[model samples]
Target: MEQKKRKSSATIASIETEYVRSLQKKASRKHARKIRLYRRLTVFAVVAAIILVGMTQMYMKQKQVLEAKELEKMEKTAQLEEVQQEQEALNRQLIKLDDDDYIAKLARKDYFLSENNEIIFSIPENKKKTDKKDNGKE
Candidate 1:
């Protein structure tokens, strides 16, 4: 069996009215406002991120400086301790120098001085070992 097909053409037209135009205008304005709000939020987020990064970098730099200063302070404290010990030793030596008996003993030992008829005997001893032991005690 053979059948013929028929085609029907139909055209639709857009409705144009004052109320519809006003509604379209209001929708466009709302869309524009939304876009502007999004743009402003994006700019604000970028600026906030930049400020946060800058503050973080500054904090890191300050931390490094603080650590360096602390290290320097520790070194200076050690140096001060050494200087104080040296000063104490010097003060002790000054006190010994002011003593008459200590001064006479030191002079007699170093210069081989003898009393009125007292004979001085020079004994040979291991100077190196005695010097090391005396230095250790001091």
Candidate 2:
């Protein structure tokens, strides 16, 4: 009777130990799953942060490009003003084309025409100096 009682108690203790080990294993699995979920969340957060920074940089770069384009437009506007001034001067020169003295000068210089009794002497400047360079090989 005593041996039977001891055997029953020993079997109950072994069952309790097995149940405790199983519970511990389940708890460890739960903790591991939580850790894995946290790691995934961390990775997602990092990716999101990087994308935000990249978008900000792209926006800033585009802004800089737009500002440069605007500055170029301003420079072009200034250049246009200078060109307008030159155009006005050219228009004044055109208005003078009907003058008889100017027409005579143009005919003499461009068409090489002169009055009947005038003696025309032509002297051409040498053009060789315009083609010279300091290169030793050439």
Candidate 3:
């Protein structure tokens, strides 16, 4: 009966040791899982940061290109407006040239022409001579 009692005590001690070892193993596994989770989260954050920076740079570049195009459009619009004004002036001049009176006036003024049996007398502008005499008197 004493031998049976010693054998039972030894069995209980071995079972207790086995239970402690299993608890230690489970703690180690939990620690390892925590480390792996931290590493995965860190890697994901770095990749996300890189992607965000790249997208911002691309957006700025596209904005600059769009602004340049808009400026060019404005310049072209101004140039077109100027050309349209010049074309309108030329059209009015062309219409004026179709009138006989305007043609006669242009010829008489620019070419010194006169009608048949009409005499032309030439007169110099008196304002310049008068201004010169006035200055001399002063």
The TM-score leader among the candidates is 1
- Give the Å shift of residue 64 in candidate 2: 2.0
Task: Give the Cα error of residue 106 in candidate 2, in Å.
Answer: 12
What C-alpha lDDT does candidate 2 achieve relative to the native structure? 0.88
lDDT of 2 by residue, 4-123 (tens): 998898888444688899998999999999999999999999999999999999999999999999999999999999999999999998988969899899989877889889877765
Each model's lDDT: 0.89, 0.88, 0.94
lDDT of 1 by residue, 1-138 (tens): 122222222244446999989999999999999999999999999999999999999999999999999999999999999999999999999999999999988878888997788888776578877988999999
State every prediction's TM-score relative to the real structure: 0.70, 0.50, 0.62
1 or 2: which has the higher lDDT? 1
Candidate 1 residues lying further than 4 Å off, grouped into runs, are 1-13, 109-138
* Candidate 3 lowest-lDDT run of ten: 10-19
Q: Point to the candidate with the largest lDDT.
A: 3
Q: Which residue pairs of candidate 1 clash?
A: none
Q: What is the TM-score of candidate 3? A: 0.62
Residue 105, model 2, lDDT: 91
